[model samples]
Target: MDLTGYPTDFVADLGFPGAARRFLERRARHWPRLFLNGVPLDDTALGGWQLPEEPDTSESSILGFARDAAMEQHWEDEGYALDDTGEGPFALFYSRYGRPLRAGAITGVAGVPEQVAESVESIGLMLSGFFVVSLLTPDDPATDPFSESVLRDLRESFAE
Candidate 1:
């Protein structure tokens, strides 16, 4: 079960020890469908580093993506569909009140998936349904509701 000749401690190198460990443990449990579109984009080398395709702006953008009308319009500028929800960019992420946001295109999926993934895993339980993360650090008590199993499943499914 060695990966692409990569070292075992690859996730740690990316400053994502927790995420790396999570991915390794869960890769075998989730449906492989999540991996179909997602690439084998792990960066175990260089100290568990996975190169990011976009600049890390999760903190600033997450809210904007969720609440800002102007920004949401821009998200649609690229033809990303906007769900009827009053919310901004994330309205399209789900049909329910709070589902984890899902992006179709890789770039549209995220500007920085690693950062977003960590943010989501570390503190996204408070959100109603499972959701993606992008620098949104909710209160641990409020957000830590998601089960480890759920997060692990997503990481494995989305592991590149």
Candidate 2:
């Protein structure tokens, strides 16, 4: 799909429960296949992306248990403190983790290095998620493009 017109700067108010689902559903009308962190997310993925309506009493009750579990574990491994916050799915995930990390995006064409593609895709998703989180949490400002603190951290990390 030609996602050249994808609105990277667009911010959706996904503060309420089920808002993410609705938003995704609406967007699917135009872009049926949405990519999050380089992974394809379609209608089937949406079912898994959402929080279950009921407790995990039976195995069948959980639609995307393994995928969700892996993702949660991945987030935890990446230093995010995934807590039981009563916020929307994306809002909850992005607000706590996305804001602090200040993720950004990049684009590449075919034949791009695997590592570069992965890094750029992940950064793009993080940045977009961060934008959504910022809208949900208006008091918390988004990271400045030319942040001295970030620059200092980079310099210190790279210093030998």
Candidate 3:
């Protein structure tokens, strides 16, 4: 959660095949909530908030709508942009505004608890360049020891 310790320059390394999955597998449980490209990974994390149905959109397009809605919630200011090259599921993940999403912005999303939103910070990763994985973690390492520890762990794992 602490950006001071995050290796922002190495963010693109996360796009390596299986890197995102391994990272999530080891650290996702420590997060209050997780999202994939703006879509909540766990519906319960939203406290039962359901995506509103669009009158003209079909069921199949609901996922896209959900992604857009979620992105609009916090990504309006500064967020990572993933450039999908459509070449074997590899995309480039880079900061659009050179900063992470703020807690105030994350709280604006429907169903996110205030405490959870305030206590957590946002981190985005590109999964094999196919999709984006966003994680909400504690803002301080002291609040959640595992939060800071994972940065080192991930860097080592990714290096391999």
Candidate 4:
């Protein structure tokens, strides 16, 4: 999938800061690949990916989710985790199949690419993949389009 339009759409939907916006815009050229257990993620594995019962945002809610023993166990069982920095404001979404996905950029951190690398290394399997549309020098590929409902809710949250 051509994610050429994702950064623009994400900014339009979430009004992300300039840094995050720049990251996605700069990285849109790459392709996203979902990985599981250090391998390519597939539909069968995605089948186990689940959306939270209620609306959630990565910055505010997903930390709790990622840290939850039960949720962590579930993601471990599925061989992946949509990791969050517990710092940057990430927008969370579900795939059409209901698999959790995340998009965001981190800025103001010196040596950001290295920073993201360190974060990923620390989390290990807790992070499955990075969005191709990202700030990193070479972002991940296009895995799947984000869920419309999640985008809508994010927009609405901004409105409120």
Cα lDDT computed for each candidate against the true fold: 0.29, 0.32, 0.33, 0.29
Best candidate, TM-score-wise? Answer: 3
The order by descending TM-score is 3, 2, 4, 1
Which sections of candidate 3 miss by over 4 Å?
A: 1-7, 11-15, 43-150
Instruction: Estimate, for each residue in 84-117, the C-alpha lDDT of model 1 and write its tens digit.
Output: 4421122101111223333332322233567775
Give stretches of model 4 more than 4 Å off.
1-9, 12-67, 79-149
| Candidate 1 wrong stretches, greater than 4 Å | 1-14, 17-25, 36-53, 58-148, 152-160
Candidate 3 structure quality by residue, lDDT tens digits, 1-160: 2122212223232243345445444333544344444555563534443323323221222111112343334333323222122101011232212233222332232234776665643533223322222322222334444434644444444545
Measured with C-alpha atoms, the lDDT of residue 121 in candidate 2 is 67
Candidate 2 Cα lDDT to native:
0.32
Per-residue lDDT tens digits of candidate 4, residues 1-160?
2221122133222223233323222222121233322344344634454323433223321211122343344444532223342211122322111233444543333323775766654332322322212211011224423223223333444443
Ranking by lDDT: 3, 2, 4, 1
- Cα miss at 148, model 1 (Å)? 5.8
Where model 2 places Cα greater than 4 Å from the true spot, the runs are 1-15, 51-93, 96-132, 135-160
| Candidate 4: residue 120 lDDT (0-100) | 52
RMSD of each: 18.7, 18.9, 18.7, 18.1
State the displacement of the C-alpha of residue 14, model 2, in Å, after optimal TM-score superposition: 9.5
Q: Model 1 lDDT vs. the true structure?
A: 0.29
